[model samples]
Target chain A: MEEIKEIMKSHTLGNPVRLGIMIYLFPRRRAPFSHIQKALDLTPGNLDSHIKVLEKHGFVRTYKVIADRPRTMVEITDYGMEETRKFLSHLKTVIDAIHF
Target chain B: MEEIKEIMKSHTLGNPVRLGIMIYLFPRRRAPFSHIQKALDLTPGNLDSHIKVLEKHGFVRTYKVIADRPRTMVEITDYGMEETRKFLSHLKTVIDAIHF
Candidate 1:
């Protein structure tokens, strides 16, 4: 239980915005910043902050494409995917344990 | 989609810790503040801030018991519970739609 608590508290993917990002990245493995912004209904500034948190924690890798629009792309690294998996699992355990 | 985004952004239960609190409160409808803190493994300071945010949003109602220990009790209002349900549902919709 203590270990679970630590994992829950320390997880970097601690917000709905970020959770949405990880889940969104799961199947596609990667996506453009604009697509994620549109899908999650997040403002560009808001999404940027959340993505930076994930990137800092090594949950997501970010890069830019020199396209006509010069788009930015985001992808969940292996570590990030594992972290998301663990965060979800820990959350479920905590919720179940606290069931009335 | 824009409306969904607005609801997601304006929602007060925006963190993992708060989400855990709502899930714990769902079955029991109410619990002591200490219990919520322990169950979610949050500090008194941390839990207090989260609870206050919920209360401010009319999602939770909080009161103090003048017992020997003076425990604070927290309850999820009907509105709060419904809001939690919507948050969960909206999150799922975003995830499904953003599937790569």
Candidate 2:
């Protein structure tokens, strides 16, 4: 429980949208902004705001990839990966603690 | 992700302390306040405040049991159990989806 509380203190990832974003990025490490928006069903504005918060916390970084056209990309930082992993581990402990 | 977002909308349980309380009470169904305080290592005031929030949301009920002196007992309500289960299930999905 104390562990969970400590993890929850990472307010940036505490939001489900942000958590979802991190979960999506954890394995991929990096993804196009459009893909994240579609995958999470978040509006452009909503996704932008969440990304800004993550960027501010050094959890993620947004950049542009000049492909067919200019495309925005979001990548999880090493710090972000470490924090997300820690958060997930604590979350699993809480889930294991509760028995149905 | 949508499922996780929906479960997180239950703001009362979103707080780590409140979530901890529910997890603690889930198996026992009921417990003395002192036991909960000790198990969660929460101060009496801290525990009381969290209990008030849970009580307001009908997640739990508090009452006195006459024993060796009067002791306050906290019990999980049916709604709480269902919500906690739902939250845990969604959480599990997020964990499962993220391949470490």
Best by TM-score: 2
On residues B1-100, what C-alpha lDDT tens digit does candidate 2 reach at each position? 6775665466787676787788888889999999999988889999999999999999999999997799999999999899889888888887977766
**Model 1 ranges off by over 4 Å:** A1-11, A67-69, A91-100, B1-7, B67-69, B90-100
Model 2 steric clash pairs = none
lDDT of 2 at A59: 96
Candidate 2 off by > 4 Å: A1-10, A66-70, B43-46, B66-69
Candidate 1: residue B48 lDDT (0-100)? 96
- True lDDT of residue B94, candidate 2: 73
Instruction: List, residue by residue over A22-88, the lDDT tens digit for candidate 1.
Output: 8778778899999999888778999999899999989999999987889999999999877776665
- DockQ of candidate 2 against the true complex: 0.39
Output the number of the lDDT-best candidate.
2
Q: Each candidate's iRMS in angstroms?
A: 5.0, 2.7
lDDT of each: 0.75, 0.85
Q: Over the stretch B2-83, how does candidate 1's per-residue lDDT look in tens digits?
A: 4345434744766666776787788789999999888777899999998998898888999989878798999999998888
Q: Across residues A21-67, which tens digit of lDDT does each residue of candidate 2 receive?
A: 89889999999999998877779999999899999999999999997
The DockQ scores of all candidates, in the order shown, are 0.29, 0.39
Report backbone clashes per prediction: 0, 0
In order of appearance, the predictions have TM-scores of 0.78, 0.80
